[model samples]
Target: MSAMQLDAPQVYDVIVVGGGNAALCAALSAHKAGATVVILEAASREERGGNSRFAGTAFRAPHQGLAHVKTVLCEQALEDAERCSMSPYTPEDYRNDLQSTSHGRNDPLMSEIMIQDAWETIEWMKDKGVRWETTLRKYYNIETQKGIIIDLMSGAPVKVVGDGEGLIRDLYNAVENASIPVRYDCPAHELLTSGDTVYGVRTRQTDKYVDFYGQVLLACGGFSANPAMRRQYLGEGWDLVPVRGTRHNTGTMLRRAVEAGARPVGHWGAAHASPQDIDAPLTGDITKTPVIPRYSYTYGISVNVEGKRFFDEGEAEFGLTYAKIGKMIGDQPRAIAYQIFDQKTIYLLQTRYSSGRPIVADTIRELATKLDVNPTVLERTVQEFNAACPGADIGHFDPHHLDGLCTSSSLAIPKSNWALRLERGPFVAYGVTCGITFTYGGIASDDKARVLNNEGKAMPGLYCAGEIAGGVFYHNYAGGAGLTKGAVFGRIAGREAALRAKGAGGEAARFRPCKMEAAISSRRTA
Candidate 1:
């Protein structure tokens, strides 16, 4: 049996796989803990950051009030803070939201850790050079009568300065400042193990294979961008849905970990999905601000191809309901829908509406023609929706809160709240479809972010975090919770991996071929 060649003479204490917010957080934390760490990024420099780069940078953390959250805000955000109102987000609020959103199926221990450590992790990231701001523009309309109110009672009031891309830039800068080596275009294929303990990663650079021996931490993203995995796990039509993040997160590392005996958990059949502009790219562009989200559907009504209202457009606040709207839209006919709004609420749409071309018509018949729906059905649907409304004054319609003006319960699908009549013209509609952000199912890990085996035992020398660390969320997740969970567990995984590496006295100075490794290497070479 031939032994696999080591990549370099210097063995890193920790080998982090991925380059996005989670991976960077882990790498930074491990390095700060006095471990020699190296990051293996699948994407090149230009295409790094995983799903995090294209995400909205809102972070849902427990805070006292505006004063408490301002501790992590940047200079500019502080200057603009007085203009915005932020309701306090308590620990109980955070805990209940997580439990309720996951339908009480979330991992209890992991959820507790995230809930407790969320705020602290945000502060830690702030210390590491993350700039935050209280921006309601992404998820809320700014034209509210009470200036700009950010009601965190069920929303995320804060966001990164330049959004997700800005977050990646800051974290990358921190990684660089720490002098950690990040090997781009080097995607890890498998874990190198001796006995049941993973000690290194096997990656191919160009044509030849090379190995980096260390404590492996998989912060790589989920399988949203992998069409085959989507079909296999998330069901049939998921393969045709557009991705809202990086194309590099194809679940290679995740599959490798599972094949290596790590346990898979969470909602494999579910994901964090949202509505996107119909013409958006298959993989979202990170450089674009606001990306392709059309979350303002809460202020209007959506119809399927047959020109019929499907779900309650005003079911809940946009932040709480936006994530699941994509899945609902995907289940529609041809996986397409149109959000119709009148001049009364057209200006209430989020800024992301600028990315879409609105189909405008003086009448519902012409609009139905443009959307390729039945003209008569479209007109009737609108009339029924309008008739069901209580005819409340539009002036009392508060976009910041759930205004009690709902449609009559007698209708088949009543608009739950903020149900204003769509009477004024010219009416406008934006085409929409499902856009998947990340897969919820992934390798299961313990509270410390240590990977667990099928038997529910911790896998030695192996850790997982970020989207790859499953069970933190199930069917649905709160907005801004993704980044917060990633940061919290990523910090834990990094620190724990580093401490373990220190206990092991770092990586071995020389390579010795174990029977298992030798056999695997020989097969690969053949």
Candidate 2:
């Protein structure tokens, strides 16, 4: 094997695969720990960050107070950061939330690791030149009372700086500062192993196989873009769903790992899906990683192919329960659903609505016809919905909170909260279909980030993190949790891999309690 200095390892201590956030964290952490590491990124330099690039808006990490937050943020943002809530989140709080969200099906140990280490790992990344901010940013909307609401979740609410792209760039810069080598367009084709004891990665460069031997850490993503894998694992119509993020996450490493005896866990065909804009492509664009999804569906109503409602639009908060509705829409007649809104609450929308033109008509019948649904069914459905609503007007609606306004008990599916009738003229509807994000199921890894074999024993010299290493999320995920988990476990995996490679540490390196230092760093990168 001709060594690709970042291309092929001549005598490296660690080989990190998939150069997204998780892989970057692993590479940087291993490098910091004195492991001569090389990163193998699938995409070329231009199309670098994987799913990690899609996130940056928010993450639920532990913080002591505004002071703790101001430490990583720029001095300019400190004033505004003090205004927002920077309350502490204990390990128990995070663990409980994880358990409740996954319905107790999440791996207990892995969840614990994610919760405990998230804060520390985030601080570590900051120490390595990554900047984080808590500055309240916003843009005014026509419908809001104040005209401008804080851009919390939509922008960088309380996560790393510059969102996902910013976070990745900083890490990449840190790698450069450390003089770490990264080989772009060189994906791992196979894991070189002897009797299940993995040793290195095999890749093809210029039509020839080259082996890079080292302790392998697979932070590569899951199979959101691979249709065959999606169909085989997730189910039928899953193949048609749009990829919400990167097209490069085709589950190649996952398949190779599974073939190499790694056990697959989580819901095979299950994924975190969304009712994406109809104009959105099957593979998302690199320039526009959506800042806002079509979450305003709850303010109006979602109708199915037969021109009727299937589930309650107001069952829960739109921001909280996207997975449930996405699944419902995915299970619908063509895996399609139209979010019907009227002129009354149209101004309440942001990026998702304003991004494209909507199907508009002066009447419900015309709008239904435009949406290709039975006009009579649509009219009748609206009439019934309006009749069921006690107070159906702009005056009674409240978008900021779940107002008690609702549809009457007579309707099949009641608009339980924020219920307003679509009675006004020029009704607008945006056709949407399910967009699959990432597969929840993956190779089982232990608390220390070691990929477990079929019998549940740790696969020596092998570690996994990010979306590829499943067990943390089962069906649904909190908005920023995936990013946090990737960083937390990625740090742990890299630390352990480096220690094991040098034979310098034992279990202490693999599974030690989180030690968060308040030693703040002053690095500004927006």
Q: Residue by residue across 308-381, what tens digits does model 1's lDDT show?
A: 98898887777778888899999999999999999888877777787779999999999999989999999999
Name the 10 consecutive residues with the lowest summed lDDT in model 1: 506-515
lDDT of 2 at 270: 77
Candidate 1 deviant stretches above 4 angstroms: 1-10, 141-154, 506-525
> For residues 1-526, what per-residue lDDT tens digits would candidate 2 score against the true structure?
4333223234467889988888988988898889989998888888788887776345666666555656767556676654454445566666766776688899888887777777777778878887777634422243343434332332113566676678778889998998999888887888866556777777757665556767889998999989888988878788887888788899988988989988888766578787777666778675554643677787788899889898888865554567656778888898888889888877766544677668989999998888889999999998899888876455766665567788889997888887888888789888877877778988999988999989898888799999999887766766567888888888889988998888834432332121101100111112
RMSD, each candidate, Å?
2.4, 8.5
CA-RMSD of model 2 = 8.5
Per-candidate TM-score against the hidden true structure: 0.95, 0.86
Best by TM-score: 1
Residue 321's C-alpha lDDT in candidate 2? 65
Give the C-alpha miss distance for residue 164 in model 2, angstroms. Answer: 3.4
